[model samples]
Target: MRRLLLVTCSALGLLALLPVNGALAVELPVRKAGLWEMKVLSGGSVPEMTMQQCTDETTDKDMSTAMSPVAKEICSKQDIQKTATGYVTDSVCGVAGMTIKSKAEINGDFNSAYTVKTSSHTEGGMGGAPRDSSSTIEAKWIGACKSDQKPGDIMMPGGMKMNINDMQKLKALIPKQPAK
Candidate 1:
């Protein structure tokens, strides 16, 4: 379950890299400021998980790190191409003994709805059990947030509610780099 979550989160981060302009700038495509729901389907191993997220331009910018600063140390290659309708990206990333090569496509409108599909191949990990998987995520705007839900808040799977910023702690869990 945790592995799935990590992959899902990383995929979303990569999708967020879709450029708002042709220069492949740092800005993510703009979406309305409100509550949005994302339903993720991962090869049927994990049941669909629907989570609501509060979004605004600033929040989106903060969450959308196609590649985190530290991630650069691990990801050796990245290529992104803008298309008439959406964007396509391919990247190679490594973490410890695992390395992954992935490609993704995003289509539809960011303001109202969009779909993201990603496929990846993982080598040198998971007991050598041929690691390959695909996932689809559909996100739609859902108007105002619940009264109790604040911006940057997300209701994750397992009925767990957490502020998106809290996810930063996961960065700490990454193994430290050996002496440079």
Candidate 2:
């Protein structure tokens, strides 16, 4: 369950680049319709993680729909801006009792390859420890989906795979926060 959570969040965060303004709908340019290979380098302690996603236009839309409500509920500020290079996103949200402030810059072409560089600060979480962190997401088109893979399929580390569309079921498993 934890692995799936990590995989899900990582994939969504990477794809959506942490979203901005659910009301406005952070509609990122639909990536080329095909398999995408993504390499993520996050923080210092965790080793680099690589994953593959079979994606399509509809799948990207579905991801935005799925994550928007949660973003709306937890995020106080989410904004995206067009830059000369590409896109820049800034967001602040509360998650699992932590308040996170993040800024990300995206560069490169979506149809071929792209890079997102992000820096963030987190405080007042379950551990009550504050920290600053950054991550780099580098992704490129691979090809069509594999024979065994389908849209929304994410091949995680160690060859484990999960369908993002199926992850809605796990919402019930998350413990809800008590009233403030």
**What's each prediction's TM-score?**
0.79, 0.85
lDDT of 2: 0.74
| Candidate 2 vs. true structure, TM-score | 0.85
Which regions of candidate 2 deviate over 4 angstroms? Answer: 1-12, 15-22, 173-180
Which pairs of residues clash in candidate 1, taking residues 3 or more apart in a chain or in different chains?
none
What value does the lDDT take at residue 92 in candidate 1? 69
Please name the candidate that would achieve the greatest TM-score relative to the true structure. Answer: 2
Worst 10 residues of 1 by lDDT: 18-27
lDDT of 2 by residue, 102-146 (tens): 888999888989998888787986669987878888999988989
Tens digits of lDDT, candidate 1, 16-99:
343323334433377788999888777855667677888788777666453355455555556677788787877666655566
**Candidate 2: residue pairs that collide:** none
Using alpha carbons, what is the TM-score of model 1?
0.79
For candidate 1, the C-alpha RMSD (Å) to the true structure equals 3.7
